[model samples]
Target: MSSSIDSQTAAQLQEILVGADDAVEFLSGLAGMAAAAVSEAAGDTIECAITLKLHRRPVTAAGSSARAIELDHVEQALGDGPCIMALREMSTVLVVDVSLDARWPLYMQKLLDVNIHSTLGVPLEISGGAGAALNFFATRPDAFSPDVYEKAEAFAAAASNTLQLSVRLRTVQGRADDLEAALESRTAINLACGVIMAQNRCSQEEAMAILTKVSGNRNRKLRDVAKELIEQLSGSPVRTHFDT
Candidate 1:
């Protein structure tokens, strides 16, 4: 189905994608916008929550509201729900009425207890073995009419590209952070080795050996030991050029 997102909504989603500080923030904004759009289209109050499963990472969830977040957590904690099923199956899962749905008894009961009588789960198309879904909750039974389903599906489709871009940006940022940390660690070790060489009148290799021995004896990370040794000499923590 074609995306139901209007040009204005598309612009808003793009704004969230570029303006958000990270993937989590982007997902939160997406959930809020999705909830608002779906609620308007359906002419009913609908709450949204997004579930994300990235490679080698624990599943994460974001919601449009506190109650929506709490409900998503309830599904995550129980380990079974329309949203989970949708993610697992990579298809839409609709519970027209929590009272009639028998697929997830425990989860449905939990939703019923909280007066959420209907739910719709739409899988998002994400690349690189990552999985995601947009989940909607409503208080009345059969809240997800055919038109609502179309709108939800369209929103999910339109969101998939931006979400993929956000995930890639997050991955790149993580790599940059790791590289910066490694550079800082290497700088500290080099500076400490210089100090040791100057004080002990030894070669660079001997100074490095001494530092390694101290690190092993102290049972600390090599970087931590190097940082501590440098701090002792300067009376402050080591700062590399990157720190500025």
Candidate 2:
């Protein structure tokens, strides 16, 4: 039986590796793939959550909808859970048969209250830094046997790759957004410069200086000042230059 299980786990790990390439439509979808793998392996309802501290704000990604949301709230409000422990320890923590396990009295009780009888969660980390936890929860007491743990570790490895990719993708997306914002600001400042040049009959550089002077004096943003100028030209005091 053990040998068969190992063979099954190996096959599943291979499938995960194949399915998890670089073609992720969204971060949530990657997490869903993980939860689905665990469910198929454990033959029960499984939930997985990935939590990371990005830019000093805690961001959570979950594969199962309800369990993920519940866990998110629990971590935010209580600040203590398996996910936190996983990130803190940077190691896998499996609590098989939670009803019988006495570790973490408060959280364990909370799990029982939610009808989660067994759990096997492993911390998902990136390069020794705190990343996220690949958490699996089930409704059966003996859901996580040794075989399950071995299979889960293999699954976690695949999920960890997805997690790392998601992180890099997000970083790239964020930088792209910043670059777009900077370009927009530059365009707005230039538009305002043109408006000032036309209104004051000054050179382009002189108009920019006026804008700077006015912005500094009023402690307002250059774009805001430019927006106000355009609105003034339009003869609409209530008109806003920017959407915000």
Candidate 3:
């Protein structure tokens, strides 16, 4: 039997997806939608999830149900599963029957304990960042036949494109946040240096030298040292040369 989504559901899914503002949430929700579509076609109960590894951190992006999310968590704890492997190998892994799959005995046993017997993982390639994968779960063995796989593969392709955009968006946002942090660090360091200059009657260069020395000696980041100085001087009388 061919598993495929109806036209109406596809339209609604598109509308729902376009509203998400972040890549993580969007992909997560997309995972749920894809699972629903495939399950509907298969006419069986199925669960779905999305996992993405970005910046070397792996997160469960979304799940078709709470159980789906929980399943992914189990795999993460064990550091083994078809989904995690799929991302690492950059390929698809299908455990047609989880209960008997020898590849990940522990991981398979965990799934079986939860009454989940089938799983499929498909990796997604996002340019300029760590990759991701879509994971699905089912109550029965061999839940994802070739027809179901084909439908999911197509959905995964579309999801990959969206995930790429989301990754890029986050990358840009991350850079902006870093820049802002650097600016704040500079401000903090300068404020601390100015305070020291007044209190010790020293030149700006001397104040900076003292700060750098303290930072190295204490094995603390320069910003951390600067922050400590600010805290200590928070309520003290203003000691800048211009203070009267």
- Error of model 3, residue 209, in angstroms: 11
Q: Is candidate 1 or candidate 2 better by TM-score?
A: 1
| CA lDDT, candidate 2, residue 73 | 58
lDDT of 1 by residue, 1-244 (tens): 4334455667788999988887678889999999988898889999999988766332647899887888888888888789888998889999999999888898888899989999998999888689899989999998889999988988887788877877787788889999988988999999999999999999999999999999999999999999988898889877668555
- Between candidates 1 and 2, name the one with more favorable lDDT: 1
Q: In model 1, which regions exceed 4 Å deviation? A: 1-7, 21-24, 54-60, 242-244
Please write out the lDDT profile of model 2 over residues 115-209, one tens digit for every residue: 88877667665642436666677878877777667667766665566556556765787897787677667766787898888888999999999
| lDDT head-to-head 2 vs 3, winner | 3
Give the C-alpha lDDT of model 2: 0.68
Show where candidate 3 strays beyond 4 Å. 1-18, 21-24, 55-57, 177-244
lDDT of 3 by residue, 6-122 (tens): 444455555655687765567667877878878975679778888878688677877888999998888887887899989999888999987678998888888989999899998
Candidate no. 1 TM-score: 0.85
Model 1 CA RMSD to the hidden true structure, in angstroms = 2.8
Off by over 4 Å in 2: 1-28, 54-60, 63-65, 127-130, 194-205, 227-244
Query: Whole-model Cα lDDT per candidate?
Result: 0.87, 0.68, 0.80
- Candidate 2: the clashing residue pairs are none
